[model samples]
Target: MTVKLTNIRIITCHGEEVIEKGEVLFNEKGILDVGQRVNTDEHEIQEIDGSGLTVLPGLIDSHVHLGMDSSPDPFANMKNEGPEDIAFKAVQQGYRFLQSGITSVRNLGTRYNVDISYRNAVSVGTVVGPRVFAAGSPIVMTGGHGHVMAIEADGCDEVRKAARSQIKAGADLLKVMATGGVLTEGNDPGATQFSEEELRCICQEANKASKTTAAHTIGTDGIKNAIRAGVTTIEHAYLLDEEAVELMLKKGTFLVPTLLAPRLILDKPGAVPEYMIDKVRKIIADHKISFQLAHQAGVPIAAGTDAGTPFNTPGLLSDELALMVEYGMTNHEAIYSATLGAAKAIQKETEIGSIENGKAADLIVVSGNPLENIRCLDSLVYVFSKGAIVHHAPVNKQEKQEQIV
Candidate 1:
C-alpha cells in the first residue's frame, strides 16, 4: 500500500539539515519521494497527518549478541538452555528490538551461528525483525577472551582459516578477539590476545572476500594493533589513550563505543560474578574518558548498547544516545552516530541509514522533536520498516481521526 506522511518534521540525515513541514511518500518497495511536497495524487494513497510528530531514519546498533539473554549473568543462564531454546530466544529478542525502533543491527558475536540463521530467516520472510549483519563467530586465540563462543585460532595461518570459515558460514563480517574482555573469567582486559600478524592475516582474508572486520579491542596496544592491521571498526576501546585516538583518526577507523555495557555491569552490582564487577569498576572511568577523547578528536563513533550484556537490554539505544550526549556529543551528533554513522560502520551506507528517495523506508515517528530533546526517541509513535507499518501506538478514536487525515 502506498502511504503519504504529511505535515511532519523530518530529520533527514543526508547532511546537517532538517525538512520542516514536509511529506514522505513510500510503498512496499522503498521510498518514492521526500520533500516539501510529494509529487503524487493524495486521493489514492493513504494519508497520515503528522502535525506534532518527528520522523527520522530508524536507529542502527552496530554491536550486539542476539543469541544471549540480557540477564544479569547471561553466561550462567546460557548453560541451562539448549540450542533450540537459545535460537527461539534470539528471534524474540530481534522482534523486541524492532518494536523499540531499531531498524538495523550488527550481531558481532554469537554461539552456534544463530546470528547468521536469524539474518537468513528475516530475509526469507520467515520472521520479521531489523536488518541483521551477522558475524557467525569471532576468531580468538586459544584460551583468549570469548573462546567458548568463538573459534580458537592461535597462529596467523589458523586465523586466516578461521576467517574463511566464518565467511563460509554466511557471516556478514568478521570479528576478532584482539584483546581480553571483562565477561570471561581470568581474562585481563588490558592484555592483548591476538598479535599484529594474526590480526593482519584475518584482515587480509576478509579483504579478499570484500567483508569488513571488527576487533574486540580494549587495551591501548591492542587498539593500535587493530588500527595498523586495517580493521574496519574497533569495539569497546575502553582504555583508549592519546596515541590510540590519533591512530584512529589517521586510519579513518570507526569506533563502536558500547558505553552502556560497562555502566550496566557496574550499576547492577552483586547480580554478576565478582570478577565482572571488579573489571568494570577498574575501567568505567577510563571508558568514559576514552569516548570523550574520541568524540572531541572527530573519531567516527557509532552508537551500540552491547545489548544482551548483563542489564544492557535490546531496546536501550535511546539510553545509549542519551549517554553519548552526556559525554560530549550534541543531540544531533548522537542521533547521527546511531544512524548514518552506524550504517557506515557496517558498510551499509547506501541502503537504510537516512530518509532519502529510493532508500528503504526504515523510519520511526516520535512524539516530539528529537533534536530538541533527545529523550523524545523513547516515545515512538510509529515504526515503518521497508515501507510497512510494523508498529503503531494505540490512540483514542478522536486522536486517531485527527492523525489519519
Candidate 2:
C-alpha cells in the first residue's frame, strides 16, 4: 500500500530551502515522490493530513553502544550478561532511539559480536528499531582501552587479523582504540594505545572490505596517528592539537564528537563512579574548546551522543544538538551535522538522511518549525520509518477517528 502525507512543511536538510505546504508519497520500499501533490493512480493509498506540522529526515547517531546498560554500574552489567540477555536489552535501547526520531544508528563496539547480531535483527525486522550499522568489537592492545569488548592484539599482523575477524562476523565497520579511554579501569585518557603501524594495518584491512574505521582517540598524538593512518572518523577527540587538526583537514577525516557523554557523567556526581567524576571534570572544559576549534576549522562534525552510558541515556540527541549550537554551530549547521553529515560519516549518504524521492522514508513530524527553534524537535507528533507510521498521537477525538487509520 502507498502512503501520502499532505499539508506538511518539509526541511530536506540537504542545503535546500524549506518547502512549505508540501506532499510526500511513499511505499514500503522507499519514498516515491516528495514536494507538491504526489501524482498517483493507486486507489489503496493511505492519506494522512499533516497540517500544522514540520517534517524532516529522521536523525542519525554516528557513535553509540547498544548493549551497555545505562546505570551507575555499567561495566557490572557486562560482567555476567549473556548474549541473549544483552541482545534483548539492545532491542529496548533501539526502540527508545526510534521514539526520539533517530532512525539510523551506528553501534561502535560491543562484546562478543552482540552489536552485529543486533544490527542484523533490526535489518530483518525481527526487532523494531533504527537501521543499525555495527562495529562488532574494538581492536585494542593487550589490557588496552575497552578491554572487555576489545580484540586485544599487539602486533600489526594481529591487528589486521582482528579487523578481518570483525568483517567476517558481519560488521559494517571496524572500531579501534587509538587512545586510552576514561571508562577503562586505570587507563590514562591522554595516552595513545596502538602504534601507528598497527593502526594503518587495521585501516588497510577494513578498507579492503569496504568498511569505514572509527578510531576512539582522546589524546593528541593518538588523534594524529588515527588521521595519518587513514582512519575514516575520530571519536571523542577532545585533546586535538594543531597537528591533529591539520592532519584531519588534509585527510578529510570526520569527527563524531560525543560531547555530551562526559558532561552527563560530570553533572550527576552520585550517578557515576567517583573516579569518573574526577576524570570527566578534569577535561570537560577542554572538550568544549576542542569542539569549538573543530567547528572553526571547518571540519565535518557529526553529532553522536555516547548513549547507554551512565547518565547519558538514549533519546538525548536533542541535548547533543543544543550543545552543538552552544559551542559554535548555528541551528541549521547543528541539524545538518546530525542529518546529512552523519549519513556521510557512515558512508550512507545516497540512501537516507534527506527528504528526497527514491530514498528511505525515514522521517519525523514536529509541532513547530525546527529551523527557527530547534527545541521544537522535542515535540515530535509523528514518526515514520520506511513509510510506516511507527509512532503517532491524535490531537482530538473526532479528528483522531478520521486521521488514525
Which residue pairs of candidate 1 clash? none
Instruction: List pairs with backbone clashes in candidate 2.
Output: none
TM-score for each of the candidates: 0.96, 0.96
* Cα lDDT tens digits for candidate 2, 132-240: 9999878899999888877899998788889898899999999999998878878888899998999999999988998899999988889988999999999999888
Clash totals for all candidate models? 0, 0
Give the Cα lDDT of each candidate. Answer: 0.89, 0.86
- Scored against the true structure, residue 167 in model 2 reaches a CA lDDT of 92
When summed lDDT is taken over every stretch of 10 residues in candidate 1, the lowest stretch is 396-405
lDDT score for residue 143 of model 2 = 91
| Residue 306 C-alpha lDDT in model 1 | 88
